[model samples]
Target: MLANSSIDNAASQAKTMFGEELIWLFIFGDLCTFTLFFFIFGHARTNNSVLYHASQAKLNVHFGSINTLLLLSSSWFVVRAASAARKGLIQKCTRALAGAFILGAGFAVFKIIEYIDKANAGISFSTNDFFLFYYLLTGLHFIHLLTGLSLIAYFIYNFRANGITRQNHATFESGAIFWHMVDLLWIVIFPLLYLLP
Candidate 1:
């Protein structure tokens, strides 16, 4: 009984330090999955250097660069949002989250335009080994971006309604953490798919 009580107390302390258990679990799982995918992509690229390089050259570096910038800026906004929330600056936090969401939307628009161009040019996942990795990796990252946008929107709405307080700051922090992960994944994806010659 004493051991059980100690364990329970430790778990409670852990929760306090980690913000939320479920969010940590999800982040860990997603990171592991992305790490595996990245490893596979690297191995494949090594085996098909010429194909990968050639196909990579066909990608629009300008668009990829712009998207990277957008995501990085959006991540900054997310961080600012969380910081503002911690300070109980509801209006500042809401504006920061909104900015992040708008930047994420711009990223989606640019990605769609790039996809349309690729389709018009007859390039797709089945085009080649490089294109396959490119599509799979970037497509996955794009889905995450869309999800992050939704999370940001939800945060915005919640902030405007109830606002973030010390009691509920964990919820805001969780959203910010997820948004940073999405941005970090893109930072890796952009270099691998667009500029890693």
Candidate 2:
């Protein structure tokens, strides 16, 4: 009976580790999709196809740069929020969450402005390959940004109504992690989409 119990414990521990490993594997797989997209895009560029650069001139770099700053700053807010949640400081956590949510909204607004300006210039997703990928990646990222905002809002509502608990901390931490991924994705994207010649 003792031996069977020990075997079961070992099996359970191994299974838990395997589950965590699988989660990381899935995350890396998504990263690879972005990586492959950038790689192929780089290879497809033509000497005459300074079309991307020309198209970029139609973009509002000032607005794009501001959105980048907003996301980067929001990342700091979420990191503080995560720390506050772990320490069980409900007020601090709520304040940080609010700040992050505001920054996320600012990013969305700037992105909308960018879309409108580009459209007015007759540049759009259907305009060319550069615009297509820009729309696809940024649009997908916009969805993730909204999802992250929703998660933060839920955290604030739950924490206000009921105070912080282990599950609340976990949810906030997970949201921070997801939000950071969105920010980091934009770091890669901005350089590729805007800066590279």
Q: What is the lDDT of residue 30 in candidate 2?
A: 63
> After best superposition, candidate 1 residue 43: deviation in angstroms?
1.1
Across 96-157, the per-residue lDDT of candidate 2 in tens digits comes to: 99999999999999999888877887877998888987898888789888988998899889
Error of 1 at 93 (Å): 0.5
Give candidate 1's whole-model lDDT. Answer: 0.82
Candidate 1 lDDT, 1-197, residue by residue in tens: 11344345444643676356778789899889989998999999999899888888889999999999999999999888866765567898889889999999999999999999999999989999888888888898888888888888888887677755443566667777888889888888889888886
Question: What lDDT does each candidate get?
Answer: 0.82, 0.77
Stretches of candidate 1 above 4 Å error?
Answer: 1-18, 166-168
Q: For model 2, what is the alpha-carbon lDDT of residue 65?
A: 85
Which 10 consecutive residues of model 2 have the lowest summed lDDT? Answer: 1-10
* Sequence-dependent TM-score of model 2: 0.84
